[model samples]
Target: MVLKRVRANFKRFIKSNAKGQTTTEYILILFVVVMVALKFRGLMKEKITSQMDTLGTKIEQITNDSE
Candidate 1:
Protein backbone atom coordinates (compact mmCIF):
# COMPACT_ATOMS: atom_id res chain seq x y z
CA MET A 1 0.00 0.00 0.00
CA VAL A 2 2.78 2.44 0.78
CA LEU A 3 4.51 1.57 -2.48
CA LYS A 4 1.27 2.14 -4.38
CA ARG A 5 0.83 5.54 -2.75
CA VAL A 6 4.37 6.52 -3.59
CA ARG A 7 3.87 5.47 -7.19
CA ALA A 8 0.66 7.49 -7.41
CA ASN A 9 2.36 10.54 -5.98
CA PHE A 10 5.21 10.13 -8.43
CA LYS A 11 2.76 10.03 -11.32
CA ARG A 12 1.07 13.16 -10.10
CA PHE A 13 4.38 14.90 -9.75
CA ILE A 14 5.38 13.95 -13.30
CA LYS A 15 2.09 15.25 -14.70
CA SER A 16 2.36 18.51 -12.85
CA ASN A 17 5.94 19.09 -13.95
CA ALA A 18 5.35 18.34 -17.66
CA LYS A 19 4.40 21.91 -18.55
CA GLY A 20 7.79 23.19 -17.46
CA GLN A 21 9.48 21.60 -20.49
CA THR A 22 7.32 23.50 -22.97
CA THR A 23 7.70 26.72 -21.02
CA THR A 24 11.48 26.31 -21.00
CA GLU A 25 11.54 25.74 -24.78
CA TYR A 26 9.53 28.89 -25.36
CA ILE A 27 11.75 30.93 -23.10
CA LEU A 28 14.87 29.68 -24.91
CA ILE A 29 13.40 30.60 -28.29
CA LEU A 30 12.44 34.04 -27.05
CA PHE A 31 15.93 34.56 -25.67
CA VAL A 32 17.53 33.63 -29.01
CA VAL A 33 15.24 36.02 -30.92
CA VAL A 34 16.04 38.86 -28.52
CA MET A 35 19.78 38.20 -28.80
CA VAL A 36 19.61 38.21 -32.61
CA ALA A 37 17.64 41.42 -32.59
CA LEU A 38 20.09 43.07 -30.22
CA LYS A 39 23.04 41.98 -32.37
CA PHE A 40 21.49 43.45 -35.54
CA ARG A 41 20.01 46.60 -34.03
CA GLY A 42 23.11 48.70 -34.50
CA LEU A 43 23.54 47.59 -38.12
CA MET A 44 19.90 48.33 -38.87
CA LYS A 45 20.20 51.77 -37.28
CA GLU A 46 23.33 52.56 -39.28
CA LYS A 47 21.72 51.54 -42.55
CA ILE A 48 18.65 53.66 -41.84
CA THR A 49 20.75 56.66 -40.92
CA SER A 50 22.83 56.34 -44.07
CA GLN A 51 19.74 56.14 -46.22
CA MET A 52 18.24 59.20 -44.57
CA ASP A 53 21.43 61.18 -45.03
CA THR A 54 21.54 60.29 -48.71
CA LEU A 55 17.90 61.29 -49.07
CA GLY A 56 18.55 64.61 -47.37
CA THR A 57 21.48 65.34 -49.66
CA LYS A 58 19.40 64.60 -52.73
CA ILE A 59 16.59 66.81 -51.49
CA GLU A 60 19.00 69.66 -50.80
CA GLN A 61 20.53 69.36 -54.25
CA ILE A 62 17.10 69.41 -55.88
CA THR A 63 16.10 72.50 -53.90
CA ASN A 64 19.28 74.32 -54.77
CA ASP A 65 18.85 73.50 -58.47
CA SER A 66 15.29 74.79 -58.37
CA GLU A 67 16.46 78.03 -56.79
Candidate 2:
Protein backbone atom coordinates (compact mmCIF):
# COMPACT_ATOMS: atom_id res chain seq x y z
CA MET A 1 0.00 0.00 0.00
CA VAL A 2 0.95 3.67 -0.04
CA LEU A 3 1.84 3.49 3.65
CA LYS A 4 4.57 0.98 2.92
CA ARG A 5 6.20 3.23 0.36
CA VAL A 6 6.07 6.16 2.75
CA ARG A 7 7.60 4.13 5.52
CA ALA A 8 10.32 2.85 3.23
CA ASN A 9 11.15 6.36 2.13
CA PHE A 10 11.20 7.56 5.70
CA LYS A 11 13.55 4.77 6.72
CA ARG A 12 15.86 5.49 3.87
CA PHE A 13 15.93 9.16 4.70
CA ILE A 14 16.57 8.50 8.38
CA LYS A 15 19.47 6.22 7.59
CA SER A 16 21.05 8.45 4.98
CA ASN A 17 21.01 11.84 6.66
CA ALA A 18 21.14 10.98 10.33
CA LYS A 19 24.90 11.30 10.59
CA GLY A 20 24.97 14.98 9.69
CA GLN A 21 21.80 15.99 11.50
CA THR A 22 23.49 18.11 14.17
CA THR A 23 25.71 19.90 11.69
CA THR A 24 22.74 20.46 9.40
CA GLU A 25 20.69 21.91 12.27
CA TYR A 26 23.50 24.23 13.34
CA ILE A 27 24.10 25.44 9.79
CA LEU A 28 20.40 26.08 9.32
CA ILE A 29 20.19 28.05 12.56
CA LEU A 30 23.29 30.09 11.70
CA PHE A 31 21.86 30.83 8.26
CA VAL A 32 18.62 32.05 9.78
CA VAL A 33 20.43 34.27 12.29
CA VAL A 34 22.67 35.72 9.58
CA MET A 35 19.64 36.41 7.39
CA VAL A 36 17.81 38.17 10.21
CA ALA A 37 20.87 40.24 11.11
CA LEU A 38 21.28 41.29 7.50
CA LYS A 39 17.61 42.18 7.27
CA PHE A 40 17.69 44.34 10.39
CA ARG A 41 21.17 45.77 10.07
CA GLY A 42 19.94 49.07 8.72
CA LEU A 43 17.33 49.48 11.42
CA MET A 44 19.83 48.69 14.17
CA LYS A 45 22.31 51.13 12.71
CA GLU A 46 19.68 53.86 12.69
CA LYS A 47 18.75 53.22 16.29
CA ILE A 48 22.34 53.34 17.41
CA THR A 49 23.17 56.44 15.38
CA SER A 50 20.18 58.43 16.58
CA GLN A 51 21.29 61.32 18.80
CA MET A 52 17.99 62.74 20.02
CA ASP A 53 15.63 62.19 22.91
CA THR A 54 15.73 58.55 23.72
CA LEU A 55 13.83 57.20 26.73
CA GLY A 56 16.72 57.55 29.18
CA THR A 57 17.55 61.04 28.00
CA LYS A 58 13.94 62.09 28.24
CA ILE A 59 13.74 60.77 31.78
CA GLU A 60 16.90 62.60 32.77
CA GLN A 61 15.70 65.81 31.18
CA ILE A 62 12.41 65.63 33.03
CA THR A 63 14.09 64.89 36.35
CA ASN A 64 16.48 67.80 35.95
CA ASP A 65 13.75 70.19 34.69
CA SER A 66 15.68 70.74 31.46
CA GLU A 67 12.84 69.77 29.13
Candidate 3:
Protein backbone atom coordinates (compact mmCIF):
# COMPACT_ATOMS: atom_id res chain seq x y z
CA MET A 1 0.00 0.00 0.00
CA VAL A 2 2.83 2.39 0.79
CA LEU A 3 4.47 1.53 -2.53
CA LYS A 4 1.24 2.27 -4.36
CA ARG A 5 0.95 5.63 -2.59
CA VAL A 6 4.52 6.52 -3.48
CA ARG A 7 3.87 5.64 -7.13
CA ALA A 8 0.83 7.83 -7.19
CA ASN A 9 2.75 10.71 -5.68
CA PHE A 10 5.47 10.22 -8.22
CA LYS A 11 2.97 10.46 -11.05
CA ARG A 12 1.64 13.73 -9.69
CA PHE A 13 5.14 15.04 -9.27
CA ILE A 14 5.92 14.26 -12.91
CA LYS A 15 2.78 16.02 -14.14
CA SER A 16 3.59 19.14 -12.14
CA ASN A 17 7.18 19.01 -13.30
CA ALA A 18 6.11 18.97 -16.95
CA LYS A 19 4.21 22.20 -16.47
CA GLY A 20 7.23 23.81 -14.83
CA GLN A 21 9.47 22.74 -17.72
CA THR A 22 7.57 24.81 -20.25
CA THR A 23 7.81 27.92 -18.11
CA THR A 24 11.49 27.24 -17.58
CA GLU A 25 11.98 26.96 -21.34
CA TYR A 26 10.24 30.26 -21.94
CA ILE A 27 12.38 31.97 -19.31
CA LEU A 28 15.53 30.60 -20.89
CA ILE A 29 14.45 31.85 -24.31
CA LEU A 30 13.72 35.29 -22.88
CA PHE A 31 17.12 35.37 -21.24
CA VAL A 32 18.84 34.49 -24.52
CA VAL A 33 16.96 37.24 -26.39
CA VAL A 34 17.94 39.81 -23.78
CA MET A 35 21.57 38.75 -23.92
CA VAL A 36 21.61 39.03 -27.71
CA ALA A 37 20.03 42.45 -27.60
CA LEU A 38 22.63 43.64 -25.12
CA LYS A 39 25.41 42.19 -27.23
CA PHE A 40 24.31 44.12 -30.33
CA ARG A 41 23.35 47.33 -28.49
CA GLY A 42 26.61 49.08 -29.30
CA LEU A 43 26.41 48.17 -32.98
CA MET A 44 22.83 49.40 -33.21
CA LYS A 45 23.80 52.67 -31.55
CA GLU A 46 26.73 53.17 -33.90
CA LYS A 47 24.59 52.57 -36.98
CA ILE A 48 21.97 55.04 -35.82
CA THR A 49 24.59 57.65 -35.05
CA SER A 50 26.24 57.17 -38.43
CA GLN A 51 22.93 57.61 -40.20
CA MET A 52 22.19 60.77 -38.25
CA ASP A 53 25.61 62.18 -39.05
CA THR A 54 25.13 61.51 -42.75
CA LEU A 55 21.74 63.23 -42.62
CA GLY A 56 23.25 66.24 -40.85
CA THR A 57 25.98 66.52 -43.45
CA LYS A 58 23.45 66.46 -46.27
CA ILE A 59 21.32 69.12 -44.56
CA GLU A 60 24.36 71.37 -44.04
CA GLN A 61 25.36 71.01 -47.67
CA ILE A 62 21.84 71.89 -48.82
CA THR A 63 21.80 75.01 -46.62
CA ASN A 64 25.24 76.12 -47.83
CA ASP A 65 24.29 75.65 -51.50
CA SER A 66 21.09 77.70 -50.96
CA GLU A 67 23.20 80.54 -49.48
Candidate 4:
Protein backbone atom coordinates (compact mmCIF):
# COMPACT_ATOMS: atom_id res chain seq x y z
CA MET A 1 0.00 0.00 0.00
CA VAL A 2 3.05 2.25 -0.21
CA LEU A 3 2.64 5.36 -2.31
CA LYS A 4 5.08 4.60 -5.08
CA ARG A 5 4.28 7.90 -6.74
CA VAL A 6 5.70 9.72 -3.76
CA ARG A 7 8.87 7.68 -4.11
CA ALA A 8 9.79 9.07 -7.53
CA ASN A 9 10.83 12.37 -6.11
CA PHE A 10 12.44 10.51 -3.23
CA LYS A 11 15.11 8.78 -5.30
CA ARG A 12 17.73 11.10 -3.90
CA PHE A 13 16.91 9.90 -0.41
CA ILE A 14 17.53 6.33 -1.48
CA LYS A 15 20.98 7.15 -2.81
CA SER A 16 22.41 6.95 0.73
CA ASN A 17 25.57 4.91 0.78
CA ALA A 18 25.03 4.02 4.44
CA LYS A 19 23.11 0.98 5.62
CA GLY A 20 20.58 2.77 7.81
CA GLN A 21 17.10 3.82 6.77
CA THR A 22 16.90 6.79 4.37
CA THR A 23 14.74 9.89 4.32
CA THR A 24 12.18 8.07 2.19
CA GLU A 25 11.75 5.51 4.92
CA TYR A 26 11.20 8.26 7.46
CA ILE A 27 8.51 9.84 5.29
CA LEU A 28 6.76 6.53 4.84
CA ILE A 29 6.91 5.89 8.58
CA LEU A 30 5.43 9.30 9.28
CA PHE A 31 2.68 8.68 6.76
CA VAL A 32 1.80 5.45 8.51
CA VAL A 33 1.72 7.25 11.86
CA VAL A 34 -0.61 9.91 10.44
CA MET A 35 -2.86 7.26 8.99
CA VAL A 36 -3.04 5.41 12.31
CA ALA A 37 -3.84 8.63 14.15
CA LEU A 38 -6.58 9.46 11.66
CA LYS A 39 -8.10 6.04 12.09
CA PHE A 40 -8.14 6.25 15.87
CA ARG A 41 -9.12 9.93 16.16
CA GLY A 42 -12.68 9.16 17.13
CA LEU A 43 -11.65 6.75 19.86
CA MET A 44 -9.00 9.15 21.13
CA LYS A 45 -11.50 11.99 21.23
CA GLU A 46 -13.97 9.90 23.15
CA LYS A 47 -11.36 8.91 25.72
CA ILE A 48 -10.22 12.49 26.18
CA THR A 49 -13.79 13.71 26.63
CA SER A 50 -14.52 11.01 29.16
CA GLN A 51 -11.40 11.91 31.13
CA MET A 52 -12.34 15.57 31.12
CA ASP A 53 -15.85 14.83 32.31
CA THR A 54 -14.49 12.78 35.19
CA LEU A 55 -12.06 15.52 36.13
CA GLY A 56 -14.83 18.12 36.10
CA THR A 57 -16.99 15.96 38.33
CA LYS A 58 -14.13 15.55 40.79
CA ILE A 59 -13.50 19.28 40.84
CA GLU A 60 -17.17 19.95 41.54
CA GLN A 61 -17.14 17.45 44.38
CA ILE A 62 -14.07 19.11 45.88
CA THR A 63 -15.68 22.56 45.65
CA ASN A 64 -18.84 21.36 47.35
CA ASP A 65 -16.82 19.75 50.16
CA SER A 66 -14.84 22.95 50.74
CA GLU A 67 -18.01 25.02 50.84
Candidate 5:
Protein backbone atom coordinates (compact mmCIF):
# COMPACT_ATOMS: atom_id res chain seq x y z
CA MET A 1 0.00 0.00 0.00
CA VAL A 2 0.85 3.67 -0.21
CA LEU A 3 1.41 3.98 3.53
CA LYS A 4 3.96 1.17 3.52
CA ARG A 5 5.82 2.74 0.60
CA VAL A 6 5.99 6.10 2.36
CA ARG A 7 7.32 4.49 5.50
CA ALA A 8 9.97 2.65 3.54
CA ASN A 9 11.15 5.85 1.87
CA PHE A 10 11.34 7.68 5.18
CA LYS A 11 13.42 4.94 6.69
CA ARG A 12 15.81 5.04 3.77
CA PHE A 13 16.20 8.79 4.06
CA ILE A 14 17.00 8.55 7.76
CA LYS A 15 19.57 5.83 7.17
CA SER A 16 21.33 7.89 4.48
CA ASN A 17 21.40 11.01 6.57
CA ALA A 18 22.84 9.31 9.64
CA LYS A 19 26.28 9.02 8.06
CA GLY A 20 26.33 12.75 7.26
CA GLN A 21 25.38 13.61 10.82
CA THR A 22 28.12 11.38 12.24
CA THR A 23 30.71 12.93 9.91
CA THR A 24 29.67 16.43 11.03
CA GLU A 25 30.05 15.47 14.67
CA TYR A 26 33.55 14.10 14.05
CA ILE A 27 34.57 17.26 12.19
CA LEU A 28 33.34 19.41 15.09
CA ILE A 29 35.33 17.34 17.58
CA LEU A 30 38.49 17.57 15.47
CA PHE A 31 38.08 21.35 15.17
CA VAL A 32 37.82 21.72 18.93
CA VAL A 33 40.95 19.62 19.50
CA VAL A 34 42.95 21.65 16.98
CA MET A 35 41.86 24.93 18.58
CA VAL A 36 42.86 23.75 22.07
CA ALA A 37 46.26 22.53 20.85
CA LEU A 38 47.00 25.89 19.19
CA LYS A 39 46.08 27.77 22.35
CA PHE A 40 48.39 25.62 24.49
CA ARG A 41 51.29 25.87 22.05
CA GLY A 42 51.89 29.55 22.84
CA LEU A 43 51.84 28.95 26.59
CA MET A 44 54.28 26.06 26.25
CA LYS A 45 56.66 28.15 24.14
CA GLU A 46 56.78 30.88 26.75
CA LYS A 47 57.44 28.46 29.61
CA ILE A 48 60.24 26.70 27.68
CA THR A 49 61.94 30.00 26.87
CA SER A 50 61.78 31.10 30.52
CA GLN A 51 63.25 27.81 31.72
CA MET A 52 66.11 27.96 29.22
CA ASP A 53 66.93 31.48 30.28
CA THR A 54 67.06 30.44 33.91
CA LEU A 55 69.33 27.51 33.12
CA GLY A 56 71.70 29.73 31.11
CA THR A 57 71.97 32.21 33.99
CA LYS A 58 72.87 29.42 36.40
CA ILE A 59 75.52 28.08 34.05
CA GLU A 60 77.03 31.55 33.65
CA GLN A 61 77.19 32.06 37.41
CA ILE A 62 78.92 28.74 37.87
CA THR A 63 81.48 29.60 35.18
CA ASN A 64 82.21 32.94 36.80
CA ASP A 65 82.69 31.32 40.17
CA SER A 66 85.07 28.76 38.76
CA GLU A 67 87.31 31.51 37.29
Candidate 6:
Protein backbone atom coordinates (compact mmCIF):
# COMPACT_ATOMS: atom_id res chain seq x y z
CA MET A 1 0.00 0.00 0.00
CA VAL A 2 1.16 3.55 -0.72
CA LEU A 3 0.55 4.72 2.84
CA LYS A 4 2.56 1.76 4.23
CA ARG A 5 5.52 2.51 1.98
CA VAL A 6 5.51 6.17 2.98
CA ARG A 7 5.46 5.27 6.64
CA ALA A 8 8.29 2.76 6.20
CA ASN A 9 10.46 5.34 4.38
CA PHE A 10 9.80 7.93 7.06
CA LYS A 11 10.93 5.51 9.75
CA ARG A 12 14.05 4.63 7.81
CA PHE A 13 14.92 8.28 7.38
CA ILE A 14 14.43 8.93 11.07
CA LYS A 15 16.73 6.01 12.01
CA SER A 16 19.48 6.93 9.55
CA ASN A 17 22.72 8.54 10.78
CA ALA A 18 21.56 9.89 14.11
CA LYS A 19 25.11 10.71 15.16
CA GLY A 20 25.63 12.99 12.21
CA GLN A 21 22.36 14.77 13.00
CA THR A 22 23.44 15.30 16.60
CA THR A 23 26.74 16.80 15.53
CA THR A 24 24.94 19.10 13.15
CA GLU A 25 22.72 20.28 15.99
CA TYR A 26 25.74 20.99 18.21
CA ILE A 27 27.45 22.94 15.45
CA LEU A 28 24.29 25.01 14.95
CA ILE A 29 24.17 25.85 18.63
CA LEU A 30 27.83 26.86 18.65
CA PHE A 31 27.26 29.07 15.63
CA VAL A 32 24.42 30.84 17.42
CA VAL A 33 26.60 31.39 20.52
CA VAL A 34 29.43 32.79 18.43
CA MET A 35 27.07 35.14 16.61
CA VAL A 36 25.64 36.44 19.87
CA ALA A 37 29.12 37.07 21.23
CA LEU A 38 30.07 38.98 18.10
CA LYS A 39 26.91 41.08 18.36
CA PHE A 40 27.78 42.11 21.93
CA ARG A 41 31.53 42.40 21.35
CA GLY A 42 31.64 46.17 21.78
CA LEU A 43 29.62 46.14 25.01
CA MET A 44 31.83 43.40 26.45
CA LYS A 45 34.98 45.33 25.57
CA GLU A 46 33.72 48.53 27.22
CA LYS A 47 32.67 46.71 30.40
CA ILE A 48 35.99 44.87 30.66
CA THR A 49 37.94 48.07 30.16
CA SER A 50 35.92 49.86 32.86
CA GLN A 51 36.48 47.01 35.31
CA MET A 52 40.19 46.93 34.60
CA ASP A 53 40.46 50.66 35.17
CA THR A 54 38.76 50.32 38.56
CA LEU A 55 41.07 47.44 39.51
CA GLY A 56 44.16 49.42 38.54
CA THR A 57 43.04 52.40 40.61
CA LYS A 58 42.49 50.17 43.65
CA ILE A 59 45.91 48.55 43.25
CA GLU A 60 47.59 51.95 42.96
CA GLN A 61 45.88 53.14 46.12
CA ILE A 62 46.99 50.03 48.02
CA THR A 63 50.64 50.39 46.97
CA ASN A 64 50.66 54.09 47.81
CA ASP A 65 49.30 53.36 51.28
CA SER A 66 52.01 50.73 51.95
CA GLU A 67 54.70 53.18 50.82
In order of listing, the candidates' clash counts read 0, 0, 0, 0, 0, 0
Query: Stretches of candidate 4 above 4 Å error?
Result: 1-21
Candidate with best TM-score: 6
- Per-residue lDDT tens digits for candidate 4, residues 1-67, read 2678667545644565343356557878999999999999999999999999999999999999999
The Cα error of candidate 5 at residue 16, in Å, is: 14
List lDDT for all candidates, in order. 0.90, 0.82, 0.91, 0.81, 0.90, 0.91
Q: Whole-model lDDT, candidate 2?
A: 0.82
Kindly list the per-residue Cα lDDT of model 2 for residues 5-63, writing each as its tens digit: 99888677757886656666788899999999999999988887675448678779788
In Å, residue 21's CA in model 5 sits off its true spot by 15
Which of candidates 1 and 6 reaches a greater lDDT?
A: 6
Off by over 4 Å in 6: 1-15
**Could you tell me the C-alpha RMSD of candidate 5 in Å?**
8.8
> What TM-score would candidate 3 get against the native?
0.54
Better of 2 and 3 by TM-score: 3
lDDT tens digits, residues 1-67, model 3? 9999998986777678987667767988999999999999999999999999999999999999999
Off by over 4 Å in 3: 1-19
Off by over 4 Å in 2: 1-14, 17-19, 51-67
Q: Residue 62, candidate 5: how far off, in angstroms? A: 0.4
Pairs in clash, predicted candidate 4: none
* Candidate 1: tens digits of C-alpha lDDT, residues 10-54: 677757887865776798999999999999999999999999999
- Poorest 10 consecutive residues by lDDT, candidate 3: 14-23
The regions of model 1 sitting more than 4 angstroms off are 1-28
